[model samples]
Target: MDPKPSARVRSRTGRALLGAIALTALLAGCTATGTPSPSEVPHATTPSPTASDAPPASDELVAADADRPLEAIDAYALCRAQTYAFYPGDFALLEYAPFDEASVLLRGDGLWFVYIEVDDGNRPADLVESGASNCIVGGTIGEPKWELFGVVTRGEDVVDDYDAPLPSA
Candidate 1:
């Protein structure tokens, strides 16, 4: 004859086993869910650089100068004159009238610098004729050791307005 388990013990063991299985299934179900939806997800936005992000330079372009209304001129005529000044190589000049502003890249002493010129409405008549400076307000170059002697006029006249040595690049 074999000894049999009591009905109460067997029932208790069955309930315990079922409870354990249910708990395991519940935990697995929670883990099986996918990532949260867009509305529920946490995210971060990165800020972008703006014009006012950096302090303006000492010789920064004047707002009034930029806002000065420009007059249109013939691109072909301006190109011919700029080509002559920057001879033996192709030079790109903005195709706008009155030569209000310009950005130039010049090489000297085996280094490059970015030069910016703004019209101050005091442009010389000769420069106006050649379409170099309609009205030069301010000009600056980015070369610490390099000094901008002045722009060479059509007749080689050097206009010495700002002569400080550029900051070292």
Candidate 2:
């Protein structure tokens, strides 16, 4: 015999070697996968508007003689007043009007005012009788032409008041 080894000793050694190799392979596989479980995964998200969002759209500059009535207060001017009077940030323009042959007055914040004259070639009448505060003013001037005087804001302050009218000409 040449220092013969027992079968029990050989079997134990083999099992230990196999166990170490299996553990190493398991660790390697985990690293290679590099994926999180469903519980660990994050959910989808929506983007929120930040302070640096694009500037609000400007009001349409139209001719005074066009089918649309003359807007005593423009969107830009309204936005400035809103900023001075209320919040400061991005905002949307809602509505503006002379609409038909109607006279409508908008007033708020000490320095801001809007007065529209919708005339049928005679005296102006107040005809902006219906519509939400935050929308476009839709109607014709003298003829039946449709126009859109969209809304505007300085941030969150609304400029939709008929309490105090601007000076009449």
Highest-lDDT candidate: 1
lDDT of 2 by residue, 1-169 (tens): 7596666567667879999999887566453368756665547596766657744322212334336542534432333332332222223422333334223333342232333221122212342232222322222333322222332332222333433343355
Highest TM-score: give the candidate number: 1
lDDT by residue for model 1 (62-119), tens: 5434443322222222333433443222333222332344432223333222222322
TM-scores, all models, native as reference: 0.19, 0.19
Candidate 1 error regions (>4 Å): 1-108, 113-120, 123-127, 131-143, 155-169
Reference-based lDDT, each prediction: 0.37, 0.37
Candidate 2: clashing pairs of residues: 93-151, 93-152, 94-135, 94-151, 94-152, 95-151, 102-125, 103-125, 103-126
